[model samples]
Target: MTLDLYRADLGGRTREWLALHPDERRRRSVQACATKDVEALWSLTEAHLSLYGGSGLLASPHTFSAYRTGIRQFSQYAETQALNLLRLTPDDAQAYVLALLAQGRKIATVRGKVASASALYKALRWAGATDTAPFVGVRVPKDHEHPLTKNPPYSAAVLRRVLGVVEERLLSACGRERERLLRARTLLLLLAHTGLRIQEALDLTWEEVHLDEDEPFLTVRSGKGRKSREVYLSDRLVMALRLDRTLPRRRSHTAGMVLPFRTRAAAAKLLKPLFERVDEQGRVRSDWRGCHAFRKQTGTRLYEALHDFAAVAEVLGHADINTTRAYVRVGGRRAGKVMRDW
Candidate 1:
């Protein structure tokens, strides 16, 4: 009855659905229509995602999680408003958007929530559960704020200071704490040098890393949009990783993971103290972007070194050059240098 229950049921059915032949899946879709089975109707969401969710074979776990979150929020709103999802109208959809705005959700957040609901309805239509798509043309408000003004990359000075703190911690620590600090340092250095998104870095395996190769690089198997790319390593980073590999790990550790931490939250928790440290002036800036700052730093430095947007995009694994541009911050000093030469 509740969307959560539907999601739970869908989780159980995912493997079963994936195993079915295309013709068999179509047959089940027709059978669900004939039998009026609500569970069968829900399975169609997975079917739609598998066919069209842009990962070619199946939607990535991250994509599925996002869609589930969006759908859950919308379903909660529908319950409060006494509206049925299958019977929702344009007015109902618009009211849900208005309600989200009233709750002070950011424009981007609202857009993602709406997109989740829209995708659910799309799957429902494919299942013949509903004829009308209420969220198809719902007008989520646009964000007018400029991208460059948001989340600026960490400067080289700040990174060096943080790394200095990490080294100091490594010197005083022992046993498991030392092992953790070592992994944390390696993870930070990888992010700083390679410009990998935190998830991408966390997902890296020992097999993907090529520290001994002449042009040392690691392969990201599935980045944003499930696109894979090679990120070459810095000499310093290669040395660090090589040292990290030689360090003794616990017998219970995951077999082939590059970083010791299993999850992004665990990695963030380990690095929080280092990233949140106060500067000499004892001022802590409210906007600390944690690991992403390292990625932006890499992008900015790469752009400076390469002077080509396309090359930066390829290194960053960004599908769009515009997205890569946002990560490349040209600070006043860099601008001044360029202008002085001109």
Candidate 2:
């Protein structure tokens, strides 16, 4: 086996694992290299994983993890088909697409996998590891262009309903549970009013908030791509945040964050009950669920009020105005409003 050909290219953790399991590594490498096609596929995937881990393509850890999973899943699928990376064809790529569809994967998930796999192949071509780019310009299935395009934004009344329910629950709870409800309520308000992503809110620290300022805003230092932006808070949101700051602590907070959770999972656990209640009571007007829907709602409201895509993009901290457009989903509403007013 030519394990030495790519041994140095392994990511830090992969290399460490290989070092710890010398016999297993030897066995796998031998198995991978026993056949010409087998060695080529294994080497290409390892190289892809190595490049992906080091590329810093996606900034958020959650996003990076998803891309990694997608790539691994595609590689496994390719292996099952006895595909060779060096001699891949567009037909092979289409077969994989069909296979994903046959497996009943969601359109979004299938698209993500295809994108990740295509990107990996692009990287391999750029590195001069592959002779041809098979997945280049491959099209995913129809009606699966983008996830946000399919999901309509939640209504303002639904946002108010979510907040009202949380407030009502807070009034009846006590002790640690009360604090949990309070945190959930504050998060819901912030998401609805501020247009901040849930992760940005979860990672927000007390020090990042400037409630005493003339115009209160949060300093999002750990935003996507580690980019920093000032997200202004509404008057009511500022007041709620201020009161939350002064409230007595129950569970210990980590990273000095405003919320008790240092991770998304913990925050999900805290907010699940409220979301379930929302689902049970049919407060949501659309199929779009989760905290991110609040971001879309805020973006829609801002676009409606400001009528400036650039300004809305700036508020949402979107690197691309097109992404902001997707979030806002303005479509013909603005034109209709102008026509009616004129």
Q: What is the C-alpha lDDT of each candidate?
A: 0.76, 0.69
Model 1, position 171, has a per-residue lDDT of 89
Q: In model 1, what is the error at residue 269, expressed in angstroms?
A: 1.4
lDDT of 1 by residue, 12-60 (tens): 5565665667667657766654444444544566657766676734445
lDDT of 2: 0.69
RMSD of 1: 5.6
Clashing pairs in 1: none
Error of 2 at 256 (Å): 1.3
**Candidate 2 residue-wise lDDT, 1-342, digit = tens:** 554423442454344433535455444433442343433433444544544544443355565556567766776776777777557799998888889999998777788888777766664554444557777777776763554666666787766666777878777899877777777778777888888887888778889999889888888876676778998888878877877787775566364668866676776666556654435667753333767777888888998899898998888889899888788766677688899988
What TM-score, computed on C-alpha atoms, does each candidate reach?
0.82, 0.73
The per-candidate count of clashes, in order, stands at: 0, 0
lDDT of 2 at 68: 67
Each candidate's root-mean-square deviation in Å? 5.6, 6.2
